[model samples]
Target: MSDDEGAGRRPKKQRPFWQELPVLIVIAAVIAALMVNFIGRPYVIPSQSMEPTLHGCTGCTGDRIYVQKLSYYWSDPKPGDVVVFVGPPSWNDTYRSNRSSNTLVRGVQNFFSYFGLVPPDENDLVKRVIAVGGQTVECCDAQGRILVDGKPLDEPYVQKDYPWVAGQNAAYPRGRVFAPIKVPAGHLWVMGDNRNESRDSRAHTSDELHGTVPVDNVRGKAVFKIWPPGRMGPVRSHDPQSN
Candidate 1:
């Protein structure tokens, strides 16, 4: 057929790269948001609370972790799961959102947050579930071990123990101590591996919730450590009570 005769069947011209880039970015952002919100997400440890297991400290790159949101769809977080959760109101006494006050800047930050370019606007923390709903938790028996349901937890993951000091009238050296606390239904008692420096449940016992985190606050279970090449591996969720 002559060139003129084939003109009507010619393929359409493609859009310029600049013209399509925005659309491509939006599409990519949508996919990432869905994955983060429903399937899983990557989080950067911001503190040393979960030391030895998941490393992070001021001026450190911190361990980037993968949190799986799917498992909890059918099951509640139990003892041993390394979980990411929002700090309850009383637990956020020192937390301040870094989101910009400018609406446009905040929107941009929010957009980038889906791609892990910026942090979330929540006081998300990582800790191990020491006790779950309807359980009694307390610290220090004859030995310096946390007791859950009146049983001592054999927690090998604890890398550092809080320093011991004599109470005003105590007969012996003691670390932080609290009376047996019955965890309310639908809540959890979580703590960090670096007991010495971690301001976890033990530090918040005086709060209204008595340092118990609501199960609803749990974001997901931390399943893997994916940052700092040498430390890449599965994040352990060892059940201290399994023994």
Candidate 2:
């Protein structure tokens, strides 16, 4: 074909940047929303509650984790899964009491939270599931180990340097030595690996559910840690059955 004819068949000129910007922005926003709402979201450890297993200490860079939102839809949370959830009302009262009450600051934080750049909710927490539904959970057997359904758990993940103890003055004072309690239906008993610092279900025994978190409150399972290149990998958990 002649040069003139070939030129006429060429692709149309690209749109100007100004005109394309809004469309690109909308597309980006939609993709981010879908990923954060349905697929997965990023969450930063805001406290040292999870310590040696998932660092989040003062003056230290916390671990950023990716939470998979779809898996729980296929199956209920199993014992040993590291999961995240909105803190129960009673739990939130203690944990989020210091969260900013300023609407403007909260608005900005919520916007970023939607993309998993921060925690999805200020009151959301992460912990390992110790028992589910009707299982009985208690701490500190003769060996100072957690027992589930009358079987002692073989937890290699509990922070060891920080010893586990029982009684009112123990590291996990509130949860250190609790009577065996049966988890109600659709509830989970969760605890932090850094038992010494975490304020998990064990710390709220006086609440209506007796410290068990409702299954519906769970957001998802934390599948991996994706921050600080040096500390990036899958988040591991021990199987109760394996014990």
Candidate 3:
């Protein structure tokens, strides 16, 4: 057992840092892509529209939600499930109107959005599903409540700025007088918990498909609020009717 014996066995060579760096980077890219495209990704709430359920107003850091992308692969987005989706063209128009006009600035924002590092796509929005395809949805029934399939939804999560003042038409215009409209096939009727501020399905009724969003546009279901520690918890799924 001398140098002559060792010479018979080739010495192992370690990979150079440069050679290994590319592999490491590719592996990381793959993992990040998989998580963002298939597993789950963090979405920052960018508006106060969802309120108490999700904060995004001035002076309040937005709530960060983990959207489970796989949830819809097994089943469709059901009524009462909170979800995120690509905004309709009309929505995008409105959102883009206020964003930076410079292409460079937008490029940076888009890059961050791709990784879930900043708020989701400026065109993405989160809201609760009030009714699914083929269901009839209307607001108010002498009680100023939202109804699905003629049954009042048990929505304890709704955040109203003022007390329900029944018979006050001005206070509940959009929330109270919506005609019983049927959701189209492969579409969803979504509304924000903060009914008063959200520009959801109700605001786009003039569109060709009324205000219902195409199911295909849905990104994922938000099953948990994972930010601000104190507010971290499983998001509640409401029942269509009160027991």
For residues 1-243, what per-residue lDDT tens digits would candidate 3 score against the true structure?
A: 899898899889998999999999878877777788788888878888998888898676888888888979988999888999998887666665434579998788767555655554447899999899989998776676778888877788885744666777675555446778899999999998987788899888878878899999998989889998988988777855543
lDDT of 2 by residue, 133-214 (tens): 9899886677777788888987778753345444533544456778888999999999888877888888888899899999
Q: Write the per-residue lDDT of candidate 1 for residues 1-243, one digit (tens) a residue.
A: 898889869698999999999999999888888888899889999999898999999998999999999999999998999999999998888998879999999999998887777888999999999999899998776666778888899999987875544453254323367789999999999999888768788777888998999998999999999998999999988898777
Off by over 4 Å in 1: 1-23, 163-175
Best by TM-score: 1
Best by lDDT: 1
Error of 2 at 85 (Å): 0.9
Candidates by TM-score, descending order = 1, 2, 3
lDDT of 2: 0.82
- What is every candidate's alpha-carbon RMSD to the true fold? 3.3, 3.5, 3.1
Q: How does each model score on TM-score?
A: 0.87, 0.85, 0.85
- Clash number for candidate 1: 0
